[model samples]
Target: MPDNMALIEERLKLYMINLWSRSYYMGTLGNMSKEVVERYIANQRTTKSNADHLSKENSALRH
Candidate 1:
């Protein structure tokens, strides 16, 4: 019975540690995803601005 109890306690500790590590990893992933989204948005805006500029230039040349 004592051995079984010790095994149970060890299992519980391992489970708790695994849970904590997974949560920490998820938090880091969330932060990285946010940064990636911000960068993508900034890049999208820059691309749109460049496209608009090129369109205007093309129009001016045609005229």
Candidate 2:
């Protein structure tokens, strides 16, 4: 399996490529494609939610 830093760097490269490609195709720096942005936002929300839920559950179990 790939090491953690390598995995993160790979993901960053992919994200930059997506953003750069979208910027180029749209011909504007501010014009990120809605779908890509939405997906990114949704994933962020999901990760936060999951983390919060896990923390709550762990705390409850400890009590």
Candidate 3:
């Protein structure tokens, strides 16, 4: 499970750095099992949501 998480993070980072090659990212994700892919997507959305919430909280605190 740890290894799988690491692999997902690595692939995600690689894809983020190479946004121009979206096909590669989609292909790599397609090779993963459906469960793993779903988890990865969920993690990404959760992370972004958390970041956005934190940013809003910080802005509110500053004002």
The top-ranked prediction according to lDDT is 3
Give the TM-score comparing model 1 with the true structure, all chains together. Answer: 0.49
Q: How many clashes show up per model?
A: 0, 0, 0
Question: For this target, which candidate reaches the highest TM-score against the unseen true structure?
Answer: 3
Clashing pairs in 1: none
TM-score ranking from best candidate downward: 3, 1, 2
Cα deviation at 4, candidate 1, in Å, is 77
In candidate 3, stretches whose alpha carbon ends up further than 4 angstroms from where it belongs are 1-25
Local distance difference test, candidate 1: 0.80
Give the Å shift of residue 4 in candidate 3.
52
* All models, RMSD in angstroms: 16.7, 10.9, 13.3
lDDT, candidates in the order shown = 0.80, 0.79, 0.84
Displacement of residue 59 (Cα, Å) in model 3 is 0.3
Backbone clash pairs for candidate 2 read: none
Clashing residue pairs in candidate 3 are none
Per-prediction TM-score:
0.49, 0.47, 0.55
